[model samples]
Target: MSRSTLWLLFAVLAVAARPAAAAFPADANPDPRSISVSGSAEIKVPPDEVLLSVGVESRAIVLADAKRTNDADVAKALAFLRASGVADKDVQTDYVNIEPRYPYDSGAKVVARLQPEFYVVRKSIGVRLTRVGAYEEVLAGLLANGAQYVHGIEFRTSQLRKHRDAARALAIRAAQEKADALASELGVRRGPVRSVSESYSGGWWRGGSGGWGNVGGGQAMQNVIQQTGDGGNGEDGTLAVGQISVNATVSASFAIE
Candidate 1:
């Protein structure tokens, strides 16, 4: 090859061999001298509302009959709820299931098919009660009206977002406190926070407050307290609406002086 051609080829190869230029600046690693700490805090508040889960199951030899029976039964339950002061807006249908029960013992293969010996229709609903005092009455009435099963009752509050925000602040404060304690133990002064990271959605945390063990460093945890119901007479006596917990965790890195 000619000298000028060889020189041009070498220059082009050199340019291609070089690493591609970055469109944005690369992220620098955090300060090595800084210490990372995580902290969590929780607040306990009395529940202001109760969530009740109720369901109905009906079965029949025909699909139409099964659906009609289920519809009628669910309407009866809904009517009972509305009459008992539950608004339409508060009653929500959670699920509707249509399943077939086959007679495996019969001369039928275990293949998946549409037709079956019997059709079972199931409907589930959620009821939100703002008044905790009406727990017993509602529980009993729901079953009497047509609810075949009562899944559970959980305590909750309307101000969940508000409590979550407060818990986050407490978490940050707890992180600062942890950093300060560690610095003191090492006989080193704690400097300003180098970086802080927090999850907006509080994590599921331990249920209780004031008696917390080593529970922190998570986000968006919900604690559900289930209240069991006995089928006897559907008479769930006055149930207590326990406290609800809001938890938060904060992770921070602070420089050392």
Candidate 2:
């Protein structure tokens, strides 16, 4: 009934009539229109250096004899490699194993007959080649010096990060382009970027027979010269027919406008 009370009620009614403003917790809020796309890229480059695994395996009746024979051959290999310009540090040992050889007689039976007939010891060395063409000569030299066990060889390049980035940039561009095209087709414009991701794979030579253990063995050495070269072998031991590839994937989400 009072003017002051009526005025206060009118003010309250006016305030209540106003629309409620949207309210949400930070994480609960979401942008409605968004698009996610992924793209991939690949690049190929020649491998620069070569890695060779060489070793010596010897078998004898006594562990001492086996170890002595293996050590002698390993010394010869290291000396030959050093003389050929390979650094002592570069010729690192990968593994050394000494074990007893078991004898199995006729009928798949474990015959305990006689003393342990043989002891086997193997010593492996890893060689890094800056000059690819020198591989053949190195092989021959090692062989002539009684370095008999040969492991497989691998070709690789050191510029991995550079090549990977190049591919990744291309992939990101591709994803952006695709997103733009999709936006155009859907009659929408690209808004702010929401998220991004990537993937990668690769690093292996194309050819070679048998495992590293078989490479330097007498039977395996017969084909060392016969191994097919991807690229021509030069005097420096550079087998040029080297190619490596890297792939990059980019997954991005952009707001739809």
Candidate 3:
């Protein structure tokens, strides 16, 4: 080994011995120890709108006849809805289905006949009523005009976003209160929030009955509190204007000092 070779070898050894640089510097202010807690809140408000699912069904030996009759009934229903103050944008044709109907034997098997007996046509319409008070009148009018099958009805709140925000605020407050209570019980102090997360769930509930039936259609938490409000009928005691529930849940971690 010559002097230059020895010098190169020494340099390489020194470089190898040196510690590698870190990708990032250590956190100057490390996260403090945290206490986690979750809270939920529910707000009940009278529904401001109603959605009614009305269907018209027709059957005939000929497919065209069935479709024609169904179309006429659907037209009459739409006109009635418009006259009852429902806007064009609020009324929608949900679906139209056409299928062959076959005669079945007592054993629930298709009769030996290979050809279908008649054709069945079904048309479903969705009507949205902004005025909760007029739901009954509109519903009855729809049935009398052309609608035959009542698939389902749902009551909803037009101001759902506003109510949800309010509920979230309440849930956050509840979480803070819960954290404070736990800290007090453990003889420790609660510090600033270290982290926060949230979730939500809610639906319309009829008085005495469970949640409203829909036409087409979380992790376990402890220390949860729930409350419900009463629902009543309209002024005329005819329509049951159920209450819409807006719920929110918040999970918060606070520094323990």
Candidate 4:
């Protein structure tokens, strides 16, 4: 070959044979300098509000009579609630039910027949009490206003968002600290946070208040026994308020440094 052509060919060969750039250190190990860890945090907050369940029940041989009586009784209860500072929005109708009371068949060897039965109607309302102590006065008012059927009282918190946010922040901080500690133990420095999560709604209701129910004109003692059996330890002659409960739980993950 000519000298110039040979020189050009040699330069081209050298350019293409540059050792493949060292193949980027194939099978390169990680820094081996960091560790990962998870952490959790929890916070408990006192309940800030209470829930009251109250209502009235009425019965009569005629369905219309029963409904009218119930309507009057409920109106009275609502009036009492309104006067007791329960806002229109806060007072909610929880339930209304109407059922028939049947008569026993007293005929022997007779054709099957059904008799028109009396009607029993019940209506209930849920009252949200911001101040727990207000339960006493509220109960008195409800009783004075002809509240016949008081169902139950539940307690809860109104400032749920505040507690939840605080818990979450704490959880994140705890997780970051854990990650840092793990990294320190492994002789490495923390990098950047990769993820975080938390659960804030871990609360429960322990005990509650009590109220009354009217057993309209039947077996009073039997009715009272049945009611007590049904309500458990909540059998108070007048009204009782329940305690509120709030709980928060959080879990967080941070990148290992």
How many clashes in each structure?
7, 10, 0, 7
Per TM-score, the best of the predicted structures is: 3
Which candidate wins on lDDT? 3
Question: What are the per-residue Cα lDDT tens digits for candidate 4 across 1-257?
Answer: 89999999999998888887565586674444434455555554444566667667788999999999999988888888888888898888778889888766776333333444689888777888776556556766776686754455555556667766776676667767877777787777788655444565543342222433433321111111111211122333443333332334445444444
* lDDT, candidate 2, 1-257, per-residue tens: 99999999999998888765534456576777899999999887666666777667788888898898888988888888989998877778888887786766665445564447698888777888777667667766876775665666666667778888999999999999999999999999988889999997654353343344444344344323323445534555533444667778999999998
lDDT of 1 by residue, 1-257 (tens): 99999999999998778776543356554446877899898877666676777777788999899999989989998999999999899999888889888765565555734368899888877898877667668767877787766655566667888888898999999999999999999999789888887764422222322111222311112223333322111224434444556788889999998
TM-score of each: 0.70, 0.73, 0.77, 0.61
**Residue 153 local lDDT, model 1:** 59
By TM-score, is 2 or 3 better?
Answer: 3
In angstroms, give how far residue 63 of model 4 lies from its true place.
1.2
Error of 3 at 245 (Å): 1.1
TM-score of 2: 0.73
In angstroms, how far off is 143's CA in candidate 1? 1.1
Q: Which stretches of candidate 1 lie over 4 Å from their true place?
A: 1-31, 106-115, 200-237
Q: Point out the higher-scoring one by TM-score: 1 or 3.
A: 3
Question: RMSD for each model, in Å, please?
Answer: 10.8, 6.3, 7.5, 9.3
Worst 10-residue lDDT window for candidate 3 reads 217-226
Clashing pairs in 4: 190-257, 191-257, 208-242, 209-240, 209-241, 209-242, 210-240
Scored by lDDT, model 4 comes in at 0.61
